[model samples]
Target chain A: MKARIRITLKNGVLDPQGKAIQNALGSLGFAGVSDVRQGKYIEIDLAATDEAAARAEVDRMCRELLANTVIEDYAFELAKP
Target chain B: MKTSVIVFPGTNRERDVADVLAAVTGSPAQIVWHGDSEVPQSDLIVLPGGFSFGDYLRCGAMAAHSPIMRDVVAKAKAGVPVLGICNGFQILCETGLLPGILQRNASLKFICKDVWLKVENTQTQYTRRYNQGEVARMICAHGDGNYFADPSTLDRLEGDGRVVFRYCDPKGNVTAEANANGAQRNIAGIADPTGRILGMMPHPENAAEPMLGSVDGRKLFESLLAA
Candidate 1:
């Protein structure tokens, strides 16, 4: 089984890196890009046979290590082989 | 008073903190490695600044899960005085020992300079040596010193008087222009509700000597010694 996780800064938290990228895009002749938000995507392979169990495990990982709940939010999807 | 400085891999300010501790208390401070499960008995436990875990994953994320941090967390819960500076402050927040997460600086730069800090609360053990509203010049050097917390948490920290230091100008006005890293409310440092755990983005140890350009940082160590 494989799990993919996406971590992102919370709505109200400032994302300076994303803003920098937005500015760079504007200067490079890319228009109509109103805003940009940066985030992280992580994929992990697990040995669990049960998709439900793997999803639960990955969910725990997201809460514990993959994301800092204070400033970032995380979600995961488990795929079956 | 005895002090123990926890040395995590890549930590470079343990010696600086130990040196200042010894100078202020007339006693040698112990150096404890991150892998050690037990923290040697001491009056104070310090998490010194440096690029712990090479700043991978996040500034102190890996270090916060190290073996010794378990013991440090236990001791902090037992009312030990734990001081976290710069990278140490990041680790403390990572461990949930303190509120707020330090993100990249608003300018996204590694800032290193002496900035004025206003002592917001003098009642805590860490700031007792300075008068309320006193301003001290302290060195802040970090790429991720911008502090962020939820609105409710910010309100609670302020209502409980846990905010210890706020970045300000020479005359002690906390203006947005004076905020070094865009911290909320210009917070430079904060203490836990019990007032024993303190985490700050500034490096007080680096500014403890007069030759270093300012001795205002020495009073923080003196306050701890007196406590």
Candidate 2:
């Protein structure tokens, strides 16, 4: 099975990198971009045969290592074997 | 007054901390490797500044799960005096020993300069040498030193007087302009609920010698000896 995770700063948390990117885009003539929030995407290949088991393992990884629950939120999806 | 400084793979400040500890305590400080499962018995445990594990996967996150941190966490919970400076502070937060997360500076730039810090609580063992509200000049060098916590946690930390240091002006005014990293409440340092563990972004060791520009940082080490 394969799993994909997305991590992002929680709402109300300041994203300075995202703001900087937005400014750069505006300067490059990319108008109509109201806001830009940066995040991380991670893909993992797992040996688990069951989709449910893979999802559970990935979720645990997110909580323990991949994402810092204090300032970021994480979600994952498991793909079929 | 023996002290132990944990040395992570990429940590470069252990010698600085050890030098200051020996100078102040009149005893040689031990350097404990991150892979060690046990920390030698000591009066103080210090996590000095520097990029641990190359600041990969967020600052201090990789080092927080190292073998030695398990022992450090246990000792901290048992009321041992644990001091985390700069990168060390980030590790403490990653290990859940401290309350908030350090975010990137608001200006989106790495800040390396001297800043004034107001001692908010002098009752803790770490701040005993300074009078309440006294100001200390220290050096801060970090790209992500902005501290953040939820509203409730911030309130509790303030209510319990756990905020040990706040970024301030030379005259001790905590104005927004004085905040170098956009930390919530201008908090530069904080102690655990028990007051035995402290995590601060400033580099006190760098300012301990007069030749280094300021000796204000020596008071913190002196306080440990007094305690």
For each candidate, the alpha-carbon lDDT, in order, equals 0.93, 0.93
* Residue-level lDDT for B149 in candidate 2: 97
In model 2, which regions exceed 4 Å deviation? none
Query: What is the alpha-carbon lDDT of model 2 when measured against the actual structure?
Result: 0.93
lDDT of 2 by residue, A14-68 (tens): 8999999999999999999999999999999999998777778888988878899
lDDT tens readout by residue for model 1, A1-81? 888889998998899999999999999999999999999999999999898788788888887777899989898888877
lDDT of 1 by residue, B1-227 (tens): 88999999999999988999999999999999999999999889999999999998789999999999999999999998999999999999999999889999999889998899999899888888999899999999999999999889999999999999999998999999999999999998999998889999999999899899989998999998666
Q: Provide DockQ values for all models, in the order shown.
A: 0.81, 0.83
TM-score, every prediction: 0.98, 0.98
lDDT of 1 at B43: 88
* Chain B superposition TM-score per model: 0.99, 0.99
